[model samples]
Target chain A: MDLATCLKKMELVGVLAFATVDSDGAPQIRNISAIHYESDAIYFFTARGKNFCRELLEDGRVQILCYTKYKEMIRMSAKAYAVPEEEQAKWRDIIFEEQPYLANVYPGDTRSIGIIFCIDRAEVEYFNLGVNPIFRDTYTLGGGTITKKGYNITEKCIGCGKCRTKCPQRCIEEGKPYRILQNHCLHCGNCYENCPVKAIVRE
Target chain B: MDLATCLKKMELVGVLAFATVDSDGAPQIRNISAIHYESDAIYFFTARGKNFCRELLEDGRVQILCYTKYKEMIRMSAKAYAVPEEEQAKWRDIIFEEQPYLANVYPGDTRSIGIIFCIDRAEVEYFNLGVNPIFRDTYTLGGGTITKKGYNITEKCIGCGKCRTKCPQRCIEEGKPYRILQNHCLHCGNCYENCPVKAIVRE
Candidate 1:
């Protein structure tokens, strides 16, 4: 539904998937629950000795995904980096406190083997299949901005009020060359398919 | 759990993930639910125009993974290929009959927009974190073979029975050179780590 709702879904779906590319260029994925979330960032912990740790260290590019039982998927594609050395312990303490089961894997002080990584910027796709005509939307988090997407009306627009009447959201603005509001556009391509002049540019 | 149970888990999961490498070498994943499974193979359908479809078509290498609510993960890595034309209709009819919801996405004849793919040979990993000390095992299906994994005992035959006592699975066979049953060995490294003679050859 929204970024906040997606974040809540991630928490409920413990053992989210974290995927990386191995040295052989094959995709590798693992289930991880040692994760703590921020409003606009995600933090996770992994053992220093594991191959997962090596992959993250060598290439910080990673994608984290969580799919809920309600048939909703939230995926974040971001470049991850180690948490600032000065604050690793502070964050690690919070994660351990929240996910007490992690203590079973790394008992007591042995958790020192854990390293913290943060994903603070990325494009996010939230897809919900629980409803008909499955809806999907994109959001940018942290410092990331939503790239220009959806359809744009070019100068060829005759402004015959065709798109304005057909738009589901009815957010289209009337002008010599009508513009569709990027944030509110459903991107269903209804206007593009119906445009008489073929004026809409799909970005 | 066993490989049979793992397959059941994948079916119960419904929305499993299949990932492939992009041209940039980044791993891309999508939630897929149109999959049909046989004892040693898996089949699925996707629209021809999707990024997931293109990735699978271009690179046949893929990893299909499903995580259960009980903290179990099943992943199969293999080379996927387009289902032969002769069998596509048979498989498509079966999938459509079983998953009526698919008809909502592509009504009746519109289903023709889909294409079938199958993965018949794969190295499978089953991991369950619900149990103490955790449990994991590998299964090779179809043409796949269990690779030369686990440690081997060389000619250095002290025969102190240290490995025999240390093996978790007790899969080590006693002889002049204590040999490990590669098929049953967990590759846990307990024997290799404890052997004083260090005769274990790790591959």
Candidate 2:
């Protein structure tokens, strides 16, 4: 299998999971119609004045999950903002292609009909969904040479599986500082990035 | 081909490409092996203090490219940072796992290991060798929804191929305002994000 085939399969069978914070700081998750990939950014469209869009404006941070029923997943984190006008017309055509009905809604005024969000940071996790536990591959925003260092357990790791669950490498064992499997680890740092206790240290 | 198969193949075949800045603010491309991917973050181990690491601390902006010999490619933009101490030991284990010989290099004191750059912003473009064209994807930082309205072309477009080359959808047809192929558009806004002209407007 090639990267293109995997990506195409993800596109064909994968569902995108979105996480956003509300005005009150409450986290919310929703499934969206599409997730667009670009050379330097990721884009998605929604209502012009929805809460989701407002949240994005207020806080540019966001996380997107794309997974297939087969257990393949890609998790990405990024900052986002609305696309500008001169750029909207070109994007609008993209929207129309995805949802032809959108063309009728905005017709000559596609600019008023949709919004585009650009991703600032991205991390992709590719994993198998079998009982046999195949292999996993992770890709980060920078070139592949860069690695994420996890934190040491400074009496901070409360044994919460948040990091474990979020870890693409599945390296953080289920216990304290929670032992990390260096062999299988991809160094994604989800444990370090999402640690509630801030216990994990880099070196 | 399944996702696992694709990843396995990528692991054996992926080539990491690096982006550096020239004196004129133009990006330069290079290939190196020090690059490695964790689940979602890209990591590299450099001397505790180097010119590149120093520059990263100041601006945190960088780009990376990875493509297979067959031409499958993924390009990303991101901010880079050095890892703090206390977190070094754990990552030391990680370093050893990936490159066991490095273990001999930093016997007891890992502090001498220098800096590790982590990339946060990420957008990916997937292109195949002879087929599959190109597709783009982006990962957001937190979690949320994106929307927009009232966008029109501004007079800023200089018709450079930067946006076209960066466009994930490849919708921009390279004309005045670059005609967008609305049918296959994902609205990921890589065009706007990378536009040298800043001609793309959201409102």
Candidate 3:
């Protein structure tokens, strides 16, 4: 599908997934209920003095996951920082509409009521759940679009099954020599990078 | 809902989100397609040699985002590391079932496959999205039937809007006293922890 088509579908039924770091440098994930998607940025809210809030201020890197009800998912990696007062005032109404209660709270607090992410780069992957025989056939006939990207299993695998366990698609099989179920693989490349032996290679 | 009911509801409907650090010490977000709930840990797959894989290997500190298709969302902070090889071999069949093509793949090749992430500690936040007034009322009325935890905003907020932009809920509002929209809040605490002034206080 085209970008506009994908975006429209996402806007209609998209769900936002978030991942952030804690004060101790551990990762955290949550679902966002309200997200303001701007051409250049996105915005959301949280309480004052949270660990994640501190992580962002100390380091502005962030990742956003947006998926459609139908399974299409998009991942965005960006730098996040606080919005200045002048900018916050301009977007106050837009922010309030999405979150009405904000109008009542945060009247005299010293804490910031908002945060923004300025996207530097984004990687989008679109998938259709139902069968699309036509596209499959075309790709098949087209000699299977060469994905120069392939995984290399190094000597460091250590025969560990951690890859098998963590695979969202269950594509890794543990045996004499670990095997990867390519057809079922989403190419997220978790296995390649996580191997203790550096067995899996993506090139 | 009980664990069984919650698991059933999440069968084909769970969203997995996570964060990892780059070489520069900045955090990045990534999404997992499927999450396997084992006895005491959660598993998902990615290529073996990616940045996240490297980050996890070097520092097992990680966080997770798991939600039930919108009915409930949970954020977890945990430590993760690779599993052992002998154990991995035992689960080979189950992994193969999920990825049938593994049979055709090589096992001993250095650039083949491996496992990652065995969660150690975790915190869960349950968000109930039931439309029925009964479910909502029960929780709202303090019936204790629906369970959830609350957080407090600290006195460290410096009025920075970083949390607002990074929030998935758009619950933060920027004003003189900056405030948060608790009604729609998901309690992800992106704003609270990311605030420059450490304003967000989690109770």
Using TM-score as the measure, the top candidate is 1
Decreasing TM-score order of the candidates: 1, 3, 2
Candidate 1: list runs displaced more than 4 Å. A145-203, B145-203
Model 1 clash count equals 0
Weakest 10 consecutive residues of candidate 2 chain A by summed lDDT: A142-151
Can you write out model 3's per-residue Cα lDDT over A90-138, one digit (the tens) per residue?
A: 5545665766545444333422445543332343334443222111111
Task: Please tell me which model should have the higher TM-score, number 2 or number 3.
Answer: 3
Question: In candidate 3, how many Å is residue A179 off?
Answer: 22
lDDT of 1 at B20: 83
DockQ of each: 0.28, 0.02, 0.25
- Report every candidate's CA lDDT: 0.77, 0.50, 0.52
At residue B139, candidate 1 shows an lDDT of: 81
Interface RMSD of 2: 16.2
Tens digits of lDDT, candidate 2, B91-145:
5456557765444333344324345666544543333322323333333322212
Model with the higher lDDT, candidate 2 or 3: 3
The 10-residue segment of model 1 chain B with minimum total lDDT is B181-190
